[model samples]
Target: MTSTPISKISSGVSRRNFLRTGAIGGFLLATGSATAMLTGCAKSVPASDRLFLREQDVVVLTALIPIVLADALPTGEARAAAVTRTLAAIDGFVGNTSPAVMDQLYQLFDLLSLPPARVAAAGLWSDWPNASEKDLLAFLTRWQHSSVGLFRAGYAGLVKIITAGWYLLPESWPAIGYVAPVRVV
Candidate 1:
């Protein structure tokens, strides 16, 4: 038995493929660990009447989280300015919301700057490759409403993903008051 040389390994696996597979593997591991952290996911947010998410939504959601938490938003004035430039970034996560979800989301925003559902929306906001600062803001505004419809339909699944990540990595919590409620007249 012998180990392959580094150059030989590179020849067999294209660097691009290697990176992609490694990312996917890490994703799966994180998802598994998050699920394990929750112990019983369905039991956590037991709003019995709420609609459930499709499997695809759940997968996209749980996976999006670590990356979101992992990416540090630029600090200080730069971040504050970015927030205004993107309409406070909530524009992306608050779109086409059901009246019910819209109202609830508004409340949630008032409370917390980045609730789990909005985190999923923020994930979608960055889906495009090399999205421009303007394009990024646009994406954040337009698609943020997606999960709102899902929420209005009674699927509170986003809550589970959020709490799962929070529990798995306590340190991932943001320094900002993303969850603090604001009073509107």
Candidate 2:
């Protein structure tokens, strides 16, 4: 396989992955082939992949950012590196870092925002040991009610995120049974 500049991003990908990552305007997606990604599945990172957005998802994410930040598109090209870092953290943990997947995920987020992703991600966070599960679920339910789109996007986006992110991990496989409530329904 051809070499990539970033390790955290490339190290996790697999042959199954068809992910890409870059700015919406200048995104560079390569899934072992320089094919156009406007259409087609780009090959499934994993058919039953769940809870992560892959490189292609990054397309959605990067594009969404321009929309999200239309009011304030980060000064001097820094583009809030922290946001990338935060995404990287979650992406690393979730493990879907394909270039295409990354772009798609960014579009998903750009369409929404931190509040929405965080809200959808609540399920992941809700299982915290210290907090009262009752209160958390209650809050999650309420949060769910408020941001159905956010919740949906989060789950969908996360699925793409993890799939592309884990494209390269040696022992990795698509996660199963991570059913996001209402996501299926």
Candidate 3:
């Protein structure tokens, strides 16, 4: 009986290490493609509409606002109106932000707009429009609790923007019991 050398057969890499390496590699690859896609998509936004966010950014925000403000947003036509108002608020807020902040927001939105980046960063495999409320909630929860600073920052930013937008609306004032100050003529 010929005895095979154990050392020669073993690659010495543990399964955990292999998986970690693979995950990192996949993340890097996805980010690279997403960056390339964002660069190519820069011109896709119409000149008239290209203020702070592109069309894709709007789509992302539309899909996410409900998830972020689940309890706050009403159902039926009220919900539709609220969403529209919130989107306009977000657009205005973005427009008013400094150039540096806007650039960072653009980068974040660009990543969220990409499929691979969305899956890798948010654990969301379904397209935003197709994603269930449960799926969206889970993704938000994960990012909110994530140890990664970038993920935490993203969670904070989304929540802040969505909540601020919703609360700033006059329609929301009644619900929140905020009486507007009277203007002095």
lDDT of 2 by residue, 55-161 (tens): 54444444333333333334555555523533454546544356675555444433223233323334333223333546444543543453334444455554444
Candidate 2 lDDT at 69 equals 30
TM-score of each: 0.21, 0.25, 0.77
Better of 1 and 3 by TM-score: 3
The TM-score leader among the candidates is 3
| Model 1 root-mean-square deviation | 17.7
lDDT of each: 0.37, 0.40, 0.76
CA RMSD of all predictions: 17.7, 21.7, 8.5
Tens-place lDDT per residue, model 1, 66-112, is 33333343456654343233331223333433557654433333211
Instruction: Assess candidate 3 and give its TM-score to the true structure.
Output: 0.77
lDDT assessment of candidate 2: 0.40
Number of backbone collisions per candidate: 20, 70, 0
Stretches of candidate 2 off by over 4 Å are 1-52, 69-73, 80-83, 93-185
| Ten contiguous residues minimizing lDDT sum, candidate 3 | 41-50
